[model samples]
Target: MSKQFDLSVMDGMDRREVREYVSSLLWQLRLCDGFWFLNVEKRHGRAEAEAVNGLVWDKMGDLAARDVLERFGPFADTPCGFWKAYEYLPWIPTVECAVEHDAPDAEGVIRGITVTVRRCPAQAGREKHGLEPYECREMHETEFRRFAARVSPSVQVECVQAPPDPTPPEYDCRWRFVLPVGAGGDR
Candidate 1:
């Protein structure tokens, strides 16, 4: 059993700091399965405040996979297809980071950062609930990416597959994301 926290309440912090904070919180809560989605709101001077979900933060991990969720805070309320019907997953605190980007077309834009934490799928499923093997497997390799043509624009994020599993259907995987981080908007 782990205690859950919200990101909406955490303001005035950078991403790395946030990650350290959340890591401490998770370690304290004894939570093995959880994830945080960081939603950054860009404003004058810098990106302003945002919100987070406590329940949604807890159920995004697999032993065979890395349980990291990016770009989630802003869309906490939005309906997500992946996390539709799971319970006991606690949402935890998130960290914010200032990203510096420099591209050919665009330069000197500030981007807010967010990181989500969770347990590996298999362990999470077995300990919290009896999840099917296939479901846990799907979560392991699923790649999530968001792209926009305007505003901050065109960021690609995904979970990279790990080495193939020797065990019949099991697979190894890793999470990866490529977003335009600096002055350049998108390249």
Candidate 2:
């Protein structure tokens, strides 16, 4: 039996066209998320909006991870695997993060990696509109944890810095992913 592939609107498009379409879609996704939070904040309040936003992101993280695994996965349960899978995250392009993989130790064991958001579109948008920064520390912490757990339950996520905590001028947020000693990762 043969399977059917639904190219849908993407059918018959050239590689350049597909890239353009995907770029627009990424922008739209980011815009929609920002607008959703703003609408919720306007209707309820910052606290309520933030709470709902956190809930949504928590689920999104897990869902995104699951989707990545399903599409391109079987990534090893190690720091390297986590980083590889993380590169495919939906928000990677939209969020524009700078990920730095750490050097291996003397024993040649991969320690982990650090992700820094130097220019967060969400924060920049809020600032551009003269709004207060969203206290996203907790939300991102949960999001990262949920995402990492899906990749490997033994993977540990640590929030080095995020909103609500004073961030350095160079970056809006930074997260550290720690691989267990025996997690089996290379340089």
Candidate 3:
């Protein structure tokens, strides 16, 4: 995977590092997702694709959290922790790079943040493939909240917006992260 991604390609170039990284990440995601589909379909069956997607989603969240912890040190379950964790998402570079405009515009509060993906690459890719958006709404309900729960059980994930549903021209998906209604955290 590293071999195909050339850091030198971005060396003092036209300020396109983010673009390069997005391309690299997109290539990687396609490769990994393809491999997962191929093997899982052969070994298990086509019926398990959603399950496999969810499994990979969960593991990726954990791994991303680990990376953030290693780089930024531990964080308490606060709105700040949520922001820090968001930086480690594998999808970040891709989305940030691909969007025509500012992608994840974050509205921050003491105990929560609402992130809106103005343009979703996953949505575009699926459209390009003549496939409908994957069941992200269902996946995020449990898997996304579980991702945040890795930081703290109180952390909540609500799909303010997601795919397989109509979205207006302004945005593709929006996620609200906050402590449960009664959690001690502020905001």
Model number with the top lDDT = 2
Which candidate gets the maximum TM-score versus the true structure? Answer: 2
Candidate 2's C-alpha runs over 4 A off are: 1-6, 182-187
Candidate 3 segments exceeding 4 Å error: 1-26, 34-47, 96-109
Rank by TM-score (best first): 2, 3, 1
How does each model score on TM-score? Answer: 0.26, 0.91, 0.65
Residue pairs clashing, model 3: none
Which of 1 and 3 is the better model by TM-score?
Answer: 3
Worst 10 residues of 2 by lDDT: 1-10
Better of 1 and 2 by TM-score: 2
lDDT of 1 by residue, 23-84 (tens): 78766554333222112212321112112221122232331012122323122111121221
Q: Candidates' lDDT values, in order? A: 0.29, 0.84, 0.63
**lDDT of each residue in 104-128, candidate 2, tens digit only:** 7878766788889998998999989
Ranking by lDDT: 2, 3, 1
lDDT, candidate 3, equals 0.63
lDDT of 2: 0.84
Off by over 4 Å in 1: 1-118, 121-123, 127-132, 136-143, 146-152, 162-173, 180-187
Which 10 consecutive residues of model 3 have the lowest summed lDDT?
97-106
